[model samples]
Target: MKSLDLSLRQKRILHIMQHNDTYITSAALAAKLNVSSRTIRNDVVKINEELAPYNARILSLKSRGYGFESEDPKLIESLNQIETAFFSKENRARYLAFKLCFAEEPQNLYDLEDEMYISHTTLDHALRDIASQFSDHTPYIRLIRQKETVRFEDDEMKKRLVLVEMLRKSWNYHARRNAYYDDNFIEPKVLDFIIDLVSSNLNKYNILLEDPSIVFLNLMIAVMYYRIRDGHILPYEPPIPKADTSVYYACQDILNTLTDHLHCYIHPEELDRLYLFITANRLLDQTTLTRETAKDYFGPNTRLIAEHFLTMIQNYFRLDFSDDDDFYITLLQYIRTLQRRSDIYNEQYTSDFVKNDLRIELIIAHLFQPLALQYLGKTLTETQLIYLAYCLCGTLENFVHNHPGDKLNTVICCQMNMPFLFAMKRRLESDFGNYLNITALLPVNIKNSFDFTDTDLILTTVQKPITRNPATDTLYMSINMTEDDLARLEHLILQRTIRKIYTASPSPHDLFINAFRHEKTGHGDPYSIFRDMAADFINAGFVTSDFLNDIIRHEENSTYAICPGVAYIYSLIPAEKSAMSILTLDHRITWNTHKIRVFIMTCFTLEDMPITFRLANLFYDEAYDLPKIKMEENPDVLTRYYLSFIDEPLTP
Candidate 1:
């Protein structure tokens, strides 16, 4: 016997039956699939007749509309699989919409609706259904429902929490898919409803939430969210609103608790303006919200989230500020006017260096604006700006702190020519006014390359010795000095020795030098180094052990000389998986035939595409120009250029 192909309505009914655990009503199924109840009833009958042999049948009891019954385990399993696939598709649609809504870019609702293959009205209904699962109200706080928006109101923070929880669940469900979405879409609407409720209470009852600034931030985040959805928000210029001192205090309390457990003080102030600036403006509140407001969303017994922020700041930045402090006042007013206008604080000073440089155009837009209008807030104070820069640099520094120095590969070149040692002392101090361990060596300098074994990378322009101790997995090198120049060599080695080398991974095309010369006596080259010193690095396990054969090849090939005073001897040799090494000889040497002393021995495992100069005329930016040069001049600048990059972490 042949089987009959099911109608679309029958398929829809069967799909719903497989998915739903409870009995489904004909009217409900009809509503879900946008068909008449009569049509759904007929479809169920047809399904019963055709699927009888498969042990699938619809049962209509007294009050229930319809349900599928299948006692066979195999049939139930098959149905379950089909139901799972159907819901997965629906979950994906909702997830995409939510992600689009939360993103900091403009969103086209129509476009997304089309992509999901649902009519605009249908999508609206579905969103409302989702919203209903988390809606509630209180005095002066009603669940605000728009054509395409839904959010929570007073005393119903649980509803808000539920909504976010649902979103999180859906997010996780979709994460394993090829295309994933974030939570940007839900945050804006959720925040909007909360703020509107607060605003209504403030206007109607004249009862301000205990901590309104936080509420205001929540409103701001909503606006920022919308702006991002609409593609109007700027990256560097994020929204900034004043945070409540009450909230900051609450954050501190949480941090205190963590400290009690961890025996480490977490600074509360670190959760200040800078941190707020990074969130989308629309994700914040327009009016202040308080612990009372947080009760519904977090549980009634829950401590305010502000407490967590405070704890985080204290732990991260070691800053502590009270609600009544001047800093608190400054922060509160700033958040209020940040999005709408820019009148909070004035820009105190503009650096001549930053002002004249056209490269920082986005920064310029930020500077001229008021404290409340610039990205997040008005342009950061000169000190604040510099501090943030230092922070950015410091993040890299920390990455360098975990490994042996000899195993490092890439060298970062900057104008200062000092690896992990930049000339931003004044700027760093001004920005980090509170004072921190800023002078500590950047992480990259103190750590081995990304690998944990060695910091073999040299971050200087001076020649250093290639010495090592295997027992402790340590490398000792005298840079920019030779056996012949004992006095100067000792001083150079003292400065070159990084007290701690941070561990960092070598980047693509990252060059690791075994030796480098700081001054331009013009004898830096791979082959120029005495063979014994080169042999020392190999024996110490700094250079690839197979390099001996390559060294012989380099010696035979044109003396491996690159220029008058420079030489480059390298090999594409593979090493053991656990091997970690980098060594350098920075001074001039009289090799087998070459007299050049400047040398760079690089061993790289290329991970990116090689350079293609064929389209140089069209490509605009060439590979060579990719190297950054500082705005300075010196007689031996070129030598320093190469040496200065030795210790710097590779940025690109």
Candidate 2:
């Protein structure tokens, strides 16, 4: 059976009907589609041909609305396939590029130019063109003096963004190819020059480009260099120039020798960049010279590069690295890049300061060596070192009365994993000495400790627990355990909590009351103290029409308070603004809302809805439910009891 092409709207209509089997009213479909009933009818006719293969039917119901039914498995499969293909093109491109860049070789333009007839001027032009390509991303990438790199800059945010894009594009390019050399595209030398130019500039900028995409870009650069060195492969049609023997021979010799040296694949584009860099630096002659001589000039310079990175991390974040990689070489590379380009440097410092800092980082790592050994499982990475130091420093300040105390009382409840908790504990004591007692709880135990009321502070792993005690006034903290871990955790937490839940009704009554609970024990809303502030208004005769109007005006400009569920509706004339309250009914009111709920509402004037929305987000962080927690079986009573807490007497 031939499949018909369907528009997105058509597909949406089909999808809606497929799930809503039985007679569905035309009005209901119209509502879902945000169109008129007549429009829905028109859509039905348009989709009829596409649905014909499945013998599908769109029927109207007296009650429910409009729905569809079909028996054709083939049709469903075809629709699914169409959907997949329609959405996957962009993803595939991104994924391919990421893979290719990482798989390529790492080399300079001089080596690549040795394999080709390209003049220095041509190579320079190609490099410049590639750099120009990224000009649009200038908000994130910029050209700064080579001698004046800083660790911090006013535009740090933009720089990070550009670095991310560069790495992403490079990775995408590499993930798509294995060999760079083929007669179907530009010479590998050209491409390599472009890749290297971008990469070197990126490095020079001292941008911390730690992203998975970097690996891909690196790989793409490598493979492309190898290909171009091996042979000329142009992808464009015609206008292909035949290579001169002398030029081809030079390129071939350089390519062959380098390939053997590099061991992995090298793309032609990388070769181009190598040639440009070597030629620009007078390193091009080294290729023709003895192998050992080339080694001296082109060796990995791993330590020097590594030191450069260590210096950056220490200055920007005020953290030191112990030179640990632990399966994080790619991450390390990115950090080094960020350090080099970050505008944190001041003219006051000498070269010795940079070297001394590297030495200090090395020394710190050695100090952490014994402490890290305490953890039986898990390898350490450089990123973890900083976190460990912070934990130890905070602990010492809190627990230690004097310098160099003995036997730290660190209880790691560790809602976090053992490795993170252990590393943190180690770094703290090693750096600060035993001046403190630290207890870290994994989230599971942290929740239990809430029951005890004994823990001074709960070091939780999860962000924004569903319940927190307000009376105790516990301090909340946000800390980064590792570079990637912090970003991932923050993203996951915010994504779940910040996005509003669209509902058809108010939260169940039980949920409303439970939402106010500081813990299992009940209390008036902690924010109820604002009522005293309100009392001052009443006693001063300020709680009048004029006062209410003032609040309304204030709300017009900015938020009055943070109210989540129970909105306080106030207006000059309640009747005039009563309709404003209707906006609150997302769905018909449901009676079952419980403790794991969002609660608070403050409505002063009809116009304050916008203000309400702005403040609604303040508590938004607290509403995310723990997936592990189950609802109680006595849900109805729980709901009623929860609501009673709010409706029940607090003062009388």
Tens-digit lDDT track of model 1 for 1-652: 2322454345556655755688878766764654567887788777788777777677887676676677773343333222111133345434543443343444455765766676777656655544443332111223354445443332222322333343333121111111112233435445545455434433442323323233333433344334434444332333334554444443344334434643543332333431342222222342444433434323321232223423433332222323323223223323333333322121212222222221122121222223212234323433333322322232222323322232233222122335424443333334322211232232333333333233323233223322232211122223332333333323222222221221123421232232332333333444334354345456656555456665554344223432223333444343221121222334445553333433334433222101111111111111122123212122244334543433343221
What does the lDDT read for residue 304 in candidate 1? 27
Model 1 reaches what TM-score against the true structure?
Answer: 0.18
Error of 2 at 97 (Å): 11
- Model 2's alpha-carbon lDDT is 0.36
Name model 1 segments beyond 4 Å from true.
1-40, 46-55, 59-97, 100-106, 118-652
Q: Each model's TM-score, in the order given?
A: 0.18, 0.24
Global CA lDDT of candidate 1, please? 0.36
- The local distance difference test score of each candidate is 0.36, 0.36
